[model samples]
Target: MDKKVAIVFWSKTGNTKLMANALKESIELQNYQADMFKAYNFDINKAMEYPIIALGCPAMGAETLEESEFLPMYNSIKSVLKDKKVFLFGSYSWGDGKWMRDWAYDAKNNGIILFREPIIAKDKPTDDILLKIKKVGIDLLSD
Candidate 1:
């Protein structure tokens, strides 16, 4: 059976969206079914349809998740995330990606299975970072 993956994210300045698109492209290249969604358009219930999920959101005020939409959506789905395979990625302007770390911790606390440590880029991603992001998508498709 073909595997399915979901790439969902919120991007204010378009940085995180760029990463999401890169991941979606890489996943498709691997022959998996991959869907990309902006946070507002994504329905939390749709996450259960995918074997793997990649979530992205830039660090917001004080190194926290974006409060307006992403955070609420995440909170709604987190409980059901137990034992689910998940990947986290996002861009950060400062503070050493503390937000991603915190988010990862919450995911773990809710029993989600993290494929790897969260991938982070500062502001816009560099070519090297984009390569790494693509690698992450490939890795998630691997057994």
Candidate 2:
């Protein structure tokens, strides 16, 4: 079995990037190979080879994904994600996490199987938040 994961993210303030790193470390601790990539640099073709994918992008401009990079890359890979388990995570500095909610709804509607509910941090992740992020990676590998 292929024990690998792909983590693609875009972070303007680095919060989202931190979550990606946490996830990568957690997965690697379990003896799984986790590759990290910036949103614009990630290749969908390469991502298709993994059973698990972790996508992160902080909320931007009125509760939305980073339009230029993350959004476009996500849209391109979303359709093919139906058969794979995905973990959606990000950070938000304002609003009531509507972005994560809307994104989760869209992903579900598109037939993407969420590993769990989308996880979001208020600004930067606290130790608790990082623990949750790590747990997701552990759970995904166990699955």
Candidate 3:
């Protein structure tokens, strides 16, 4: 079977973008095709084309998902994402990563099959954070 992964994200200070790129590289290293897009540029209609979908967005004001673009796009594509191997990742500056937890909880409730635990970094990603993300990428498409 052809292995493909889609990475969609929104970044303000580029931290989340950095995470997205690292994930893409790692997945490619594993010889799987990985396509990436900024939240506004992603086409939700094509969501079903990939069995694995990774969504990234930094925690915004009040530690919520990026509202103007990311959240709306996520809301639209999430239904199609049910039964797909979904991964959630992002960067956060404050509030103890409540946003990611809440997001993951909601995804589980909505019947999305999460590939693994959500990854979160404070501000810019450290070497440790990047390494862990790379591992997640390497293992993402596997059982």
Candidate 4:
């Protein structure tokens, strides 16, 4: 089967959504399939069938994951992601990106092959930030 990537995200203020869109564009522009969906709009069962994934969300207060419907849904699939290659993305309003750090560790413990650090930015990503996200996208599709 041809290679493809799935993008699942939850964005309240559109910062994270912008990242998701850029990532999707980057992946599809590589001639690969990129499935984009809001976290609530996503179907996790179908996502596990994909070989790779890109998960995005804005860091909530005190560097915590957004406690949306997606969190519990993601927890159920956490173990199953052991054999999958995944990328994490999000936006931060304040404080250090501890959420991303701890999240990275947790996913690593579950055996997911993390590609680089989780992409993080303060509030909306500016031009430079999007450039970095684009680089992450290139990396995701490269190998």
Candidate 5:
């Protein structure tokens, strides 16, 4: 069997958390092993044990990243992200999703391979948005 995959994120009002859950289901739908984690409980070192990492977060103030748990968790794992296969998704209310774009840029610089363009949604995601998150999970397993 291949290495397991983990979808980790921070969600305020459950927006991004639901996205993470959907991703877990999607990967499982592909007959692959997957897991979900909140930002605070996430362990970068332990996560390093897995080959795939799916990260999600909301667009916070001024379209910057949600600083509370998102920044710290990501910063802890950022350096080792190089060469890891990653998929990114998030919910946004405004600002053209600069947060997701900035995250993708950072991952790229860290040498992680992106499976696709970032999955983004404005405000709370509908079924259509959840479907995209599902596809992201399948894409990761396919890789």
Candidate 6:
């Protein structure tokens, strides 16, 4: 079976993008095909081609998904995500990561199967956090 995973993300200060890159590297290290995309370049129609999807967006404006691009793209693809195995990760500068919690709740309510709880890091991810992020990628290939 093809075990391809898509890592889609939006980053303003390069923190979230760094996390996305780490995920892509980790997934690829496990010998799984992983594709990385910025939210603007990612076509939602292509989402279902992969068995697993990883989304990253930092907390923005009262701990919400980035409004301009990521939110719209996510909203557009959310309905199609039903029954899809997905994971969420991101970076935050403030406000206790309420955004990730809300996102996970919304995904669950929409019937998206979450591989695990959303992974969050404050500002730029530290080396330790990167390790956790990589583990999340490795876990995607677990049976």
Which pairs, if any, clash in model 4? none
Instruction: Say which candidate scores most in TM-score.
Output: 2
Q: Which candidate number maximizes lDDT?
A: 3
TM-score of candidate 2 to 2 decimals: 0.97
Root mean square deviation (Cα) for candidate 4: 1.4
The C-alpha lDDT values of all candidates are 0.88, 0.90, 0.91, 0.82, 0.82, 0.89
- Lowest lDDT 10-residue stretch of candidate 5: 134-143
Q: How many backbone clashes does candidate 6 have?
A: 0
Q: What is the lDDT of residue 106 in candidate 2?
A: 92
Off by over 4 Å in 5: none
Candidate 4 structure quality by residue, lDDT tens digits, 1-143: 67888888888899999998888888778888888877776665867778888889888877878886657656767876777778899998888889889888888887887877888879899888788888877887765
- C-alpha lDDT (0 to 100) for residue 92 of candidate 5: 86
lDDT tens digits, residues 1-143, model 2? 87799998999999998899999999999898999989998767967888888899899999998899889999998877998889999999999999999999999999998989988999989999999999998998885
Model 1: C-alpha RMSD to truth? 1.1
How would you order the candidates by TM-score, starting with the best?
A: 2, 3, 6, 1, 4, 5
Quick one: ranking by lDDT, best first?
A: 3, 2, 6, 1, 5, 4
Collision pairs in model 6: none
Clashing pairs for model 3 are none
Task: Give the range where candidate 3 is weakest over 10 consecutive residues by summed lDDT.
Answer: 41-50
* Model 6 misplaced regions, further than 4 Å: none
lDDT of 1 by residue, 16-131 (tens): 98899899989889888889887777665887777788999999999999998999888877866675679999998888899999999998888888999888999999888889
Q: Answer with 2 or 4, whichever has the higher TM-score.
A: 2
Query: CA shift at 133, candidate 1, in angstroms?
Result: 0.9
User: What are the clash counts of all predictions, listed in order?
Assistant: 0, 0, 0, 0, 0, 0
Model 4 scores a TM of 0.92
Task: Report the alpha-carbon TM-score of model 3 versus the true structure.
Answer: 0.96
